[model samples]
Target: MTNHLEGVYQIHHIFSNINYRFQQLINSSSLRLKIIYCANISNEILRFNKEQIYSLSLNESFSINLIDSLFIYLESLRITSINSNELLLFISNFQSLPCLKSLTIKLLQCDINHSQIYYEIFSLKMLKYFKLSIDDYSTSLQSSSFNPNKQMSHLEYFIIDYQCFLPSITNILSYMPSIHYVSLMKLFYYRSSLETNYPSIWPNLTHLSICLTTWDTMFECFEVLISKIGSKLKFFSFKNYHRNIDYFNASRWENLILKFMPQLDKFYLKYTENVDRILRDRDNNEETNDFTRSFWIERKWILEIEINNQNILFSILPYKKQWFNEENLFKLNQLVISRININKYNYFIQDDINRVLNFTQIYHLEITNENLFIGLLLQITNCLFELRSLKIHSLLLEDDSRDLNLKEISILYSIHLTSQIKKIYLRNLTNIKQIDFLMKFSPYLSFFKIDYLHNLDIPSILRQINHTYLNSLCFYVPTAD
Candidate 1:
């Protein structure tokens, strides 16, 4: 029967009949199996059961006798959600599984005071990858937690979510020789209370993300630490959200970036418009009216402005369209114009159009308006021919504007104007007739996103478009409405 079963590859009641059948298979000359068990089974099954199901179980502490017997045959095991008591029990019965290569234990909820997980986990000789996410307070209590001294000689990837009363850069740097990628999210603490000096180099760390929030003297303290470590830092993100902008000056930012980071590729700033304006104002003060003349001379790096202020337009322009020339200004790559009253200033239309055309390199463009006329639309489309990505927000079609129809508009302007455009975003296209006409021309478009269109036949419009190259399509409508 066993030979016949092996020939045909059938085991009907193998686990249930482990005592009678398990040893036969283990001893069989023909049978070969790599067992994988996912269900929660206990020590009682291991001791009394006749059949064997590869001897791997999810439950950590079944029974002492069962564990002892099963340890000989156990190839691999995974235990999850083990409490402090259960963890201690598993550690006490720790006989090495020679074939075990993979292990995962989630200890975010485990009680640090009662659990011996920290001490016992490092003793695992074969662990290749390890992940630990702990609450900030539990990591700082000077109890005999997991020491970083364990020679994880083979360990490749290590992730830790640490939240302690205090964060130590020295402690992290000590273990930096082995770690490749480090993600530090919301590691919040008061900087004034920290007693130790910061470290200079994190040798093997290729990637890092840190969020710091401080008050009063904390800014100065962080600045000193950053200056010391900034040379070795490759990728950096610094954000400070304070009510008083005066406290955090722009000079501090310039000193850090200009002095320290030579190989930095990407930098993100999320603060008020005043931050840039303040810097500009300071520059203008030093150079007087020759601000543009002295701008590039002092700062050798190319500065890209990500601005959302209409006031910036007014400030930069001496008198709308009359003062500023498109040829003189720096090239803008991305322009986001959102919900501003530009109808009062028709001169701005001609100036903005000229600016867009002159740049010829803008990759991303966003225009938001509730009352843009057909003439203005035509002018915009004419200039936006070089755009690679376009987004139109809250576009309202006037009843009595220019007579340029949608089909004519597409053929004459949009299709030819933006031949390189890959992504198009449209919002609040209340008019169905206009959208139906837009669907015909965009062929190279890979992404199309639409939101809040009441009258349009969405499904039919989607079917009409030849989206052979389309990678992403998104439609959003209010469920309640």
Candidate 2:
């Protein structure tokens, strides 16, 4: 087989384990290899052409020594899982893999000594692009200690997928003197207990993106951050889960940008809040044209607002593309579904009920109506061609005596076979008929979340759900029951 495929430059193998024949074939080939989910790979199988292979990607469990010994000349290496002890051992031997310029570790075992990890990672003098994601069990590094002489990393781009406090982020930035771009997957607020000094300004840093996790003192902490690095930032993006009314105050943002971020060429901001929390201000005749000011207009940044039954989203045009986005989240997408009604305070409106329906590229659809008829569901699925997930409050027939005609049945069957939906969330489900309809409608469904069984028993619902080949099943029950 290896003789027959002599010209092959790349190979991807997905297997439970590597055998002697596979090892012999890999040893003879000078191909860039991608081995996925091959667990407990023995060291003998990893003997390959180290000089011929410059890039390697592995998604499996194996000894750390294999990395240090086999990939000395590799320019890029990606590993899916690495524990703290293995990471520390690898750090101790960073000199072995001097050719490693781009390294990505997807999952690092949660350990408290993250400061040590950061310090060691910064010691990699030749690395340029590095991405690390730590598990949630790891706590933030309360204090960081770095030797300035040994920790100046030449890395130009960095992505950190762990949530860290403001001071912790600053501490990490202090060591990366050559970094031009940085992305913090989630930035948490600094607490009073963790005492640490913020770093000096990063003049070389040009691009920054942050997803703030805490609301308390979030703006204040960000303000302090801007005071240090704002002048040099050419691109900035911010995202948050909850809303503070001040975030929408365009004038405030304009003042900040003009005063500090003078070099800013592109800005992206997104914030969301639940409907109940912001409903009080919905009646107030507040103007929504703040974003239409000259500052934003001159920059050609247009504001887009999306309000659904659950939450309101505020974002700027040319929206930031996906960056480690959360899974199983269903939000209204304005790029796909347009022609929505503008609400009174210009925030929340009956947008989904608008008459103007067009071809929508939205991937997720959440129906919050009390009663969603079969015909309306068909219409929605027909328009949202890219829809992959559906969350409905209730599913029922418009009339009890009505039954589907030939066309309706035909449409339903088409949806069952052609629908891209892999997730179905049924909220306030009261009958088995709704479950039966949903199961048949989404034949490829992988995740089913039943928020509440209003009048149905838990055992019967579980028994019915047991029939589907689902990857996951979720149930939410209230205490009142």
Candidate 3:
């Protein structure tokens, strides 16, 4: 059993007695184990000294004392099953990690005290990513005004998983001027909480997704919210559950998009069975609804709309070309062309890579399968020397044809010999044996969209990595019907 555990990376399902033998086992395993998915644990765990751990999804048993010892340099942390007060205390007390960037807190409850909760979040100056999820038993109304003026410069993406009233959402947005994406799992409002006089705005917000569960009219609520969104807004999504309003006028949405969101590219609308009719009618009127059919035809101004069953999507063609000029090109740090349409070849992206080769400062690059991305990588290696984030879709190690092999994988690694990519996203790679091969690069990757991970794979992948301060890990296994 000991020999079999030699290169293991995870110490999971562990509930044990702490003896000298356990101490030896821990010391032997400490060098490789970089992650802990702990269960019932005790203070004795402090004796293990799993030094390389950079990410922890800890339980309540790993209380404040254990936390103080373990949280020193962790880049990502998810505290499972804790109450709001405990979360606030932990965050407030956490005064010194200069590198902690991504944080996920799963609270068993919440408080309406917005200032206290938010102050701790904004206080983490280097934190760019944040996710807060509340348990089902949570009862906070979140009605109080969060009069916020402080600017959180590093805050970029914020996701709050609670049924919150709009004032809290709007107020929170007002404080996070640098935020790009805002996702609210659910939305609720009391009649009194809707203050007509309060003026708030998220100046840099680009994407917004919200869930609505109410029978009351949302038009007035939407109008107030939309008025605050100045032109940088691009995507807006509404997911209606438990209730459906009289069908929203298509013209109303279009007019709102035209007037308030000049740069809007896409929007989503979803609801229940009144949703049933919307789906069918949307399909029948697909072409007319599409914001535009061709970029050249409507290059000046016009949006394309399409329906994917229940989803009504609007596409804005050439909306990004205005950035092809010298001034805006400097601002193009993130480029995402990772979506692979099964039906068509991604030749357009190949052209884009060549066209943007003159651009020398892009920090993030997202590419799809090699049929669209292989050559682009070679071109990018020459131009973008400061690349920090690389997201690739459908990264398969094996294909029927003989274009790539282990040697090719090494060549791909050579391309990044000069760049330090901090975040990586890859999906749909079915070759199981290559997981170990990929593990060799785990030390270099701060974030991974490992959608095909299995339980047995964690130990080995984590074993060799002395995780960096920028580390974050995400696992996804596609659900079976």
Candidate 4:
């Protein structure tokens, strides 16, 4: 699925003698390392609880000859405890990494003037994605601070946070002419009286993700921010910790998105249980979960605002729709839902469900969650007439006594629509006794992979089933930690 990855090699600093061995092996390969992280490579005092830095000695005048050795072919690199006293010396070797596109830098402590630091960062022409976790909010970057000679035209994504709020951030962004994606970790840290008249600053920005401190401050620069950057944006996502649903003006927000972002997508809106009042009816406890949608769908393409406590990604797949035909809609074959958030009986509207139900070409389906399979699983099994490979992920059960839900057990009987089902992967699933219930759906099912097999009676259950059709059966017991 990914063409960018060629090979991955990681050297963890787990032992005393691994460092010398790592250097010896690194020189053996001529191929460039796309990603490299020498975890805890520094011998400095671990004052902060950040990821341990693994490099050379903590002496004041240490040789960075080792960094030059491995960094010659690195595309992505991470370094820790870079000398705060002599910051420029630490980054002098950065020019050697001509192919370096991504860098994550964390410093122990320092108060280097923001001008020099900002200049150094902008000078990296090839660097695209940079995470400035330096925790220094002070900035001397203004409208004129950017050097015309030092232009980062290739930079696309940046992760930067400043406590002074949007004014400071806006000052920095005014210089970056080609960045398409930016993660403003703190968009509203404090109120700013500074006004931004520059609209061209965010002209090329297509993907914008902001972590708002509160919705109260969201409306402060709401109109200005959206009016400037929203029109060209393809993807927009914002998440805050507050529990207020009133802050999100759905109609106004919809209009803004409609007017600004025309190239939207069909991604699901995933939210956690904390804001249940807005999406789920708390009072209504019926057989079906009363789920409300915050997204929109029209002509098979969807524009959505997703919220999740788990992992959230802000990405947009660009396609020319004018040259595309209607037949491309049915080309989907793989459907995967990681972190199953939907509970039983949770369903969408008739039209909404049709979008998913009509994906008849889907064969590889996957679902993973800590507990309770989504209600859509039943709908999928009942509707997907051609499902072949089914995979389910669940947490390890507390004890072997607990049994799978009755609704879960009944899926074997409802999988008649998927007559071509050949393989099944139940990964990290608890209660192996449930394997006995598969006698009904075992006729055409040949390959079975079951992980974390806690119960001892799984062998006896498989023996009961006639192995004439079952070609592969793998039962793995998890090694004790």
Candidate 5:
């Protein structure tokens, strides 16, 4: 097997328990390996060609002493879940790997001073891309003087996957004037009166993504930072969890884009706020048209406003893609159905539903209607091109007096073969016939979760819906007995 796989350039080991011998591989000169190291291998320093391996990823915390035995001339290296001492040792070994251009470290150590880590990372003169994820909430940069000879990093890309304060990011950016791309997965704002404002040093920076997890009062500081560095951005994405009424000012955003961010080709904004608090402002009734201006229309950035579970979300994004997933199912379920319920009396009108819902953009859908009929479900599948996940609270048909006709059966069978739906959740299901009806149209379904199974033939349903993709089947058992 080793001889057969000697030509393999990329090797990814995802297993956690497999104790594969590293000595079996005699030729790993061109191998780009990703492995999860176990404690048993910590005592054995496995040797290999350190010069030819271009990339390596250690997915677990291994002995820091093993760093000396690993490849030194690696162009890219990723280490996950390392401690403070392990991080310090790795930093000491960075001096040996001058060819290392991309370095990623995910540190699990908490409640420790990360200032030294920050300093040593920036000292990597040849590094072009650097990403750090620290689990510690207090991962702030302490004041540390850089080496006089090595003042700045040549890094062109920087990313922080942890919640870091904006001031600390700005301080780090002061040493990375060559950076062109920056992504802050979670940015926080901790008020500090002594924090000094820095000028925009990254003249070549073009792409920026920031997810602000700060208090509402942090908007002012956030705006200041954007104004300084947002001028040259080609792509800008900003998401805020903290609600501020100022974020609703579309005119302000338009002005900022028109004046400062003229080079921006794409702009994405997701602002969420409490539904009751925002709707209380009656003056904002006409604010919906604020985003429909020529500026937004020219960019093809569609504006979608949704009210879900007590929160209202305002999103502005390009119309080229659908951003639906399991995490967004709760919101999409309400948004999609609300569009159909616009005319309360015409809820069952197929023509109105077809006109209201754009089937192409609707991927994941949920039907909470207690009075849903088989005809209405068939009408929905007629227009849907890429339906992925379907969750129905109750498919209790209003009229089960008749079975599907020849034409209806053909449509259901065609959808069963072509439909992209892989997940189905049935709630308040009381009959096996309803399960049989769903299984006919969802032949590709992989995940099925039923809310209840009182007196229903569960084994029969499972046998009837048996398929290779059916890996997950869940039922809610109310009692132990």
Candidate 6:
């Protein structure tokens, strides 16, 4: 019995079994004071055995009658799941737990007919964190009776997993005066319709995350939020498909950030499409040159080329020859070349190669699953002089692949271009020779990561390189066929 109880800090059971165990544990001192309980136990059972438990997680069927007994020992409670009916039943029960700190309620599947009672529950004086995860879309329209004007002095962290709604934001601002962190996930589109002034409501919030679709919508939503609370925001993250936009339009937000939130410290932007346009247009202004003008107009030409076969040949003609003198052509070509988007299997013209060689200020370069012909590789070797981080992703490996030769090029270029690189991440690198080459070139590199390299002798390579300055190394080998 002692051995059986040694590691058993938690017990989970159905209602009937919980009753029997509740009685048994109450009688036996050894089993009464367990740390956690997750079960469909009734309020009577929890009340009867209240003194022995420290943590409790009830199923949807948990009743409100248990609150009186549970609150007496609720300080250790960290997680809870309640349904609409249970919430309605337990509206008054919330005030019983003066020490309750964390609460998670499942309001997604529950009917909102009793949402008026929600406000009554928000009066909990000791609650610090609240997570409301709504599973159903229609439930968002239901207004909670929770009044915003009532002060929830202790509440600090609030998470709403649904669309952003005006009422929800207002209610939170009116209630939780101390909220510092807020996260909204799986937000629906309609919630953006809320017209409430933004910066005014969220003056105290410091950290925020919104998961939505499209960069345009995200920018608009952020504009609204910032117009009100931008001065107070310090950290921001946009996750999933919430803010999808073309690179050119997305870069406009830089001005928006500079204008509204001068104190902003951290920003993360990610998308699955081409980012070259966004990087190129980030500094666009009215005093642009012919080069910038031609670069800007070429996007229209590329789109036309995609739609019409006749323009493909003309579009394929070198833009440098058409734009400038032979002497200045190389320089203009390099500037325009960096602005061009790379699609599948396009041969690198001499201008493209020259552009890469001249663009020495590029600090981060990502070549992912794109075919880089030898000419392009040479240009990359020449231009990537100031690169601090390099990522080579999804390069295919054949028995006679050219990637095996990249290590030598990498070493030679790193020595000539600049020895500023401290991190290199290689994903799906199938060549061992390439690995050996990079090891020789970057002896002072601090971090090296290689994932999904086939048939590579990892241990032997580690022994050969024995990189003195390398602080982190990761290798993933494929299983035998």
Best by TM-score: 5
lDDT tens per residue, model 6, 1-481: 8766654533433555889986676756444353444444344556566655555665444445756744454644433455666676675666777667777666645566433544654677777877767666665545444443644556688777765454455555565667778777754434344465333445578877666633345456556655566666677665546324322242354555567766555644333322232234333442321222333323211110110111110011223332112232212222222232333533233333232232223444555434234334444544555555556664432323234355435646656345655677777655555665566555567788777655567775576556668887777766669
Model 5 residue 47 lDDT score: 52
Candidate 1 clashes between residue pairs 3 or more apart in a chain or in different chains: 17-50, 17-51, 18-50, 18-51, 18-52, 19-50, 19-51, 136-163, 385-417
Per-prediction TM-score:
0.45, 0.60, 0.50, 0.51, 0.61, 0.54
lDDT for each residue of candidate 5 in 25-61, tens digit (9 for 90 to 100): 4345555544344556523423545554567677765
**Model 6 weakest lDDT span, ten residues long:** 304-313
Per-residue lDDT tens digits of candidate 2, residues 1-481?
Answer: 8865753423323332356567667776555554432555533345645644577776766666666645656788777777776777766766677788988876555564666666677777678999888775345434554455644778899898877666666666777778889998777766551444545546788999988776765455566667667888999998875576566556667878898899998899886755455644332334432565567767756564555435666676542433212242223343322223334432223334221122113566666666766755665676566677776777776545455556557878787657887877777787877777777788887888888777788788766664455787788877874
Can you give the lDDT of residue 214 in candidate 5?
68
Stretches off by above 4 angstroms in model 6 are: 1-36, 40-49, 52-54, 59-66, 76-82, 113-117, 143-154, 186-203, 212-222, 239-252, 268-481
Residue 57 local lDDT, model 1: 39
Ranking by TM-score: 5, 2, 6, 4, 3, 1
Model 1 Cα lDDT, one tens digit per residue, 235-290: 55544443223323445555565676554444443333332344333332332322
* Higher-scoring candidate on lDDT, 2 or 6: 2
Q: Rate the local accuracy (lDDT) of all candidates.
A: 0.47, 0.65, 0.55, 0.50, 0.66, 0.50
Please, what are the lDDT tens digits per residue for candidate 4 over residues 1-481?
2432322222233443587776555534442322232336432222221122222223233455444533444566665556454566666667766666877666554466445666777777788887665544333112233343635446688776533256556666777888788887666633342265554766788777776654465444565576766667766666554443333444444565667566644212222224224334222232122112223323233221222333222111222242112133333234455433443434312232233332124545565545433334554554556666666775333324344456545665655544666677777545543454443554577777877655656656566557557777777866669
RMSD to native, candidate 4: 12.5
Q: What is the C-alpha RMSD of each candidate to the true structure, in Å?
A: 12.7, 14.8, 17.4, 12.5, 12.5, 12.7
Q: After superposition, how far is residue 152 of candidate 1 from its true place, in Å?
A: 6.7
Comparing 3 and 6 on lDDT, the stronger one: 3
lDDT of 3 by residue, 26-140 (tens): 6664443345555445334544553445666676545554455444556776777877777777886555665577888887777547567777888788888888887763575
The alpha-carbon lDDT assigned to residue 79 of candidate 3 equals: 76
Best by lDDT: 5
Ranking by lDDT: 5, 2, 3, 6, 4, 1
